[model samples]
Target chain A: DVKVTQSSRYLVKRTGEKVFLECVQDMDHENMFWYRQDPGLGLRLIYFSYDVKMKEKGDIPEGYSVSREKKERFSLILESASTNQTSMYLCASTSGPAEKPQHFGDGTRLSIL
Target chain B: AQTVTQSQPEMSVQEAETVTLSCTYDTSESNYYLFWYKQPPSRQMILVIRQEAYKQQNATENRFSVNFQKAAKSFSLKISDSQLGDTAMYFCAFEGGGSNYKLTFGKGTLLTVNP
Candidate 1:
């Protein structure tokens, strides 16, 4: 079975704080993605990495950035988090190609106060 | 650009019954993939079923199945013998072929199975 792990299941941060959410996948998949899930918006992609040190902006990337230092780890960084930044964050990975389904991690629920 | 639409925001079903969640999409590309994903309270997104655009037959997995209407651009999921654990938010997604692997998702439908 493929396992995608998120560092924190629940996180609380003060407004304007720098926050990091880490994701790791064991399947050696070539594609990694970060998304924020809201009530009606579904999951909006934030950023994605196809290789080490490579990143691409998704539909919603204004308040977020990402880092893929190694093949297994991808990190989402909130430069200056605000109250609106609070949401459920999800990380996913795929082996590549459109036919492959992404394996998702148990999301991190972040609350900014 | 690809877009997915799941109209039913919330649905309820009795245990041991059946329920269908509606999904529609708009895309110019003929070659693509459609998927139904389940997210329970656990917060992990699980693939419920997948349907290939080229394939004429619908995709089914155990109690979960998909009705794929190619010309109408609709993909609906049918869950039979609904169980207690079937309660979750179901999302409809579209994926393009070739190197474009990112998914475009619908708003999602929250389904609750009642006893």
Candidate 2:
């Protein structure tokens, strides 16, 4: 079985504070993604990395940045958290183009107070 | 550009019943893939079923199946003998099918199964 793990299941941070959400995949998949989920918007991709040290911005990447320093780790950074940034963050990894389904982490619920 | 749309926001079904969720996608690319992902309260996205655009036959996995309409660009998921555990937000996703594996997801439909 494949596994994707998020560093924190639940987190609370003060507004304007820097926030970091970590994701790790045990399967060593080449592709990793970060998304923020909200009530009506579903899952909006924030950023994605196809390889170590390479990243691409997604549709709603304005308030977020990502880092893929190592093959197993991908991190999402919120430079300054805001109330509007409070949402459930999800991380996913895929092994590349055989049409295999993406494996997802449990998710991090971040609350900006 | 590719886009996925799920018209139904919420749906309900009684135990042992069947329910279908609608999904439609727009893409200029002739070849691609469609998928149905289930996200329960656990907040983990699980692939329920998948259909390749080039395949004429619809895809099925046990009680979960997909009704894929290629020309119409519609893919709908049907859940049979729904159980309480089946209650969750079902998202329809699409991948470009080539080298780009990034998924474009719909707004999702929340399905509730009542006992």
Candidate 3:
């Protein structure tokens, strides 16, 4: 079984504050992704890393960035947290095969006040 | 660009009954993969079933099966003998072939099982 672990299950931050959401995968998958899920909007990709130090912007990349310094860890950074940034964030990892399904973490429910 | 659509926002079914969730996608690529993912409340998303465009046969996983129509770009999931544990948000996703492993997901259908 694959294990994808997020640093926090729930978080709260004040407006204009910087926040970090971390994720780690035990399977050493080459691809890691960050997504924000909203009601009636589905899961929109924020950022993805195909390899260490390589990142690509997804559909909704504004106000957010990502880091992949190591093979097993991927981090999402919120430059300036706002009320609208409050949502459920998910991290997923998958191996080399393009057809393989992404394994997801439990997700972090972020609240920005 | 690829896009997935789940027209039904919510669906319900009684225990021991069957329910179907519809999904449609728009893609110019011929080779791709389709997936159904289940995300229970406060739980991680898990893959329910998958289908390959090249394969003509529908994909099934135990009580869950998919009706895959490649030409129409339609893929729907059918759950038989639904149980309480089946209540969750179901997302239909698409992945194009090659090195790009990005998945385009639909808005998702919230399915509730009544006991």
Off by over 4 Å in 2: none
List TM-scores for all candidates, in order: 0.98, 0.97, 0.98
Ranking of all predicted structures according to DockQ, beginning with the best and ending with the worst: 3, 1, 2
Off by over 4 Å in 3: none
lDDT by residue (A10-37, candidate 3, tens digit) is 9999999999999999998999999999
**Model 1: per-residue Cα lDDT over B2-48, one tens digit each:** 88999999999999999999999999988999999999987799999
Among the numbered candidates, top lDDT falls to 3
Better of 1 and 3 by DockQ: 3
Kindly report which residue pairs in candidate 2 clash with one another.
Answer: none
The alpha-carbon deviation from the true structure for residue B12 of candidate 3, after best TM-score superposition, in angstroms, is 0.5
TM-score (chain A only) for the predictions, listed in order:
0.98, 0.97, 0.97
DockQ of each: 0.79, 0.73, 0.80
Candidate 1 on A1-113: residue-level lDDT in tens? 99999999999999999999999999999899999999998998899999899899999999898999899999999999999998999999998876679999999999999
Residue-level error in angstroms, candidate 3, position A105: 0.3
What's the lDDT for residue A55 in model 1? Answer: 91
